[model samples]
Target: MNTQMTYTAFLDEQCLASGPLVDVATAIQQHANQSNATVLIFNDQTGKQIDLDISGSKQDIQQRYAEHPETVKKVGRPKLGVISREITLQQRHWDWLDQQSSSASAVIRKLIDKELNDPNSESNKMLAKQATDRFMSAMLGNMPNYEEATRALYQGNKEVFLDLIRDYPKDIYQHILKLSAYAF
Candidate 1:
């Protein structure tokens, strides 16, 4: 099943809401309306905070979404903001790329965009693993079985990794799960 991007909103150290990204604005607004609290929205995949521009009216929001510029490349001269760059590759690499694709640049760009756009790709899984490591180090370094958990995470042993982190604090464990959700 396909899942929409999930966001978690926090008020101080307490979790206010965790749901689809589109619902975060309503979550934040509800939290603010109920209590004098400011919300911080975080992407569940990367654990990075996102700032929402909630000052605009409904029409302004609609206009912005309607006029959103496309970033993906089309079958023509690249996007409006695309800049040409000079890249030097080894002769063999250039020859190989030329044999595989119409143009070396296009092949390289396609490879990059493929990795960037697919969260389930191997490159992205590696990134999620790295994020899990960072989070584990910060929050679980002093906990038991840290080394074992790290090993299991890197080795892609899901059962062992889960078992190793089973005794961790609930919030930290949940955050770790969120961070490593895409790693496998």
Candidate 2:
């Protein structure tokens, strides 16, 4: 039986491997079964299964797997890369926040269900993109310290945001307080 396989279908580079031959064979077999292409596999004493090396972002790969369920299940597991965006707003921003996040399209919808349901909701902050944008814009044209600090946060630099949070803790505390009243 000849198990000679070429995974050029996934990548341009010539791949040399001596393991997980089964997984590749299985994946090919599944694709062949579903398509007009001819796929042949000979299961022998040498057992091997390795993931087919495909190059793409996690989100792109997940989308590919979603489109080809049978093929993915036959050979490999799709990796999930989720990003959680967190925002912190004050408890005093309820009226407007509630009205905004309640709408189905609002990205902050999940935060509202979790925080704004109870009358005595103590959530001082929220987690969302809108909140982050609002927070950044509010810091514009303020005192030099606040202006500089807020500028770094909105500039989309992770290191700057982290540093600002650490160096100017008082500013953050105050800014969040002011924005609390208008987080709609």
Residue-level lDDT of model 1, residues 3-122, one tens digit each, is 346777666545677777546666566556668767777766565667865545545434443335677876556655456777898999888997983677778888887777787888
Which lDDT tens digits does candidate 2 get at residues 1-184? Answer: 1223322122111122212443444454445445654332211121111243233544444454333324333322234322245567677665566667354225465665556544234332222223444444433334335555455544444455445554434544443433332222
lDDT on C-alpha atoms for all candidate structures:
0.72, 0.38
Off by over 4 Å in 1: 1-6, 11-22, 53-67, 70-86, 113-122, 133-152, 155-157, 167-175
Give the number of colliding residue pairs in candidate 1: 0
Model 1: worst 10 consecutive residues (lDDT sum): 58-67
Clashing pairs in 1: none
Candidate 2, poorest ten consecutive residues by summed lDDT? 8-17
lDDT value, residue 20 of candidate 1:
70
lDDT of 1: 0.72
